[model samples]
Target: MNGHQIGEKVAVKVGTDMDEYSKPVELEGILKSKGDLLGYLNATNDKVGEVCTLSIGNLDVIIANRGDSFITINHFTRAGVEIEDYDVIVVKQGYLFDELSAISKLDILAMTPGSTYQRIENIDYKNIPRPIFPMELA
Candidate 1:
């Protein structure tokens, strides 16, 4: 209900692998907020076949069934959602670019500003470690 529509390109985080005869899990309950326990929404899996895009790092895959949101990396068998649908797909992963390079047109490292990815020079060290490489080079 976040205004997301079908056929829109999006990248989603990798989910657990599904088996061939996996059953569709359904849920129906009130999503409550923390502390106050106030009800957020009366959530249910009524619209099972609604289309939505799953976003990874730079890649977006169009998924028709809501169940397909938890899709496998196997691209050969999946219908509708194909690699050709995206120009530059970003799969939010690390150290696996080499394996995916065979099917990719180009690869790029898209880093964003965050505490986890702050530059070394910008960091305020509590205690300076002895004999650091780049930190003590200049």
Candidate 2:
């Protein structure tokens, strides 16, 4: 069934072992905006209670709302390992509005990388927390 049709309560498999599974949990969230690439979910007032299970592929990611601005994800079976971040996380749901237009813009930029893009060096990168993986690495 499609994600939207799954409704309030649904059974989701958790853990590598098929035997270990979480009970059918109630899913709650507002479908704030439906973007082609990602569906923005505002879980600020979601009645998730304590924790909710999210199935990405075969992995079951446990998510819990810590407050209005933050949500925490506890890596499966890793007690101490928790990932907490802003609630506005991108949850990829689908594709973009105009694929061709998007590609053309990127292609044009790529053709004139040096001429089109300018760099400002010697800035304090430590001030802000880099969101993406590569940005964090840099």
Candidate 3:
């Protein structure tokens, strides 16, 4: 199966051809914070540069580096609400630019109704257990 389908379940090839399955998951959360977009102007900060942080459910995901035409969803695991990169199983899909235009234009300020950036450092996914398919920290 292709990675784009919203609820499609598929087996993802992990390191050294070990197969692990993950479903295409989507959560409607807010754009919590947007880092300095200009940081990407220099090639040196390419992949490490973060463009936006999305609050999906109780999880905060960092969408790094702007100027790309698609949004990549990756499989991941949480260690007490902290997201660990090794858990990322696959790039579910690359959302097309036009398709995400409206979402991209979202009012980021709305995410921080009262608090500041320092107060909202990470997504609270602690309730979710590790090594489970289709489940994130609660």
Summarize candidate 1's per-residue lDDT along 1-138 as a digit string, tens digits. 134344344333332335322434332222111111111121332233333344444544443332322222333122334546556555432323333576666766545323333356655567767667867864
The digit string of per-residue lDDT tens for model 2 on 34-137 reads: 11111123323333323344444434344433312111232211212223322223311122234323323232222211211222242234566656355446
- How big is the positional error of residue 120 in model 3, measured in Å on the Cα after superposition? 37
- Residue ranges of candidate 3 with Cα displaced over 4 Å: 1-22, 35-43, 47-51, 64-138
Candidate number achieving the greatest lDDT relative to the actual structure = 1
Better of 1 and 2 by lDDT: 1
Clash number for model 3?
3
lDDT of each: 0.37, 0.30, 0.33
Scanning candidate 1 in windows of ten residues, the lowest lDDT window is 31-40
Rank list by lDDT? 1, 3, 2
State the weakest 10-residue window (summed lDDT) of model 3: 72-81
Residue 116's C-alpha lDDT in candidate 1? 32
TM-score of 2: 0.17
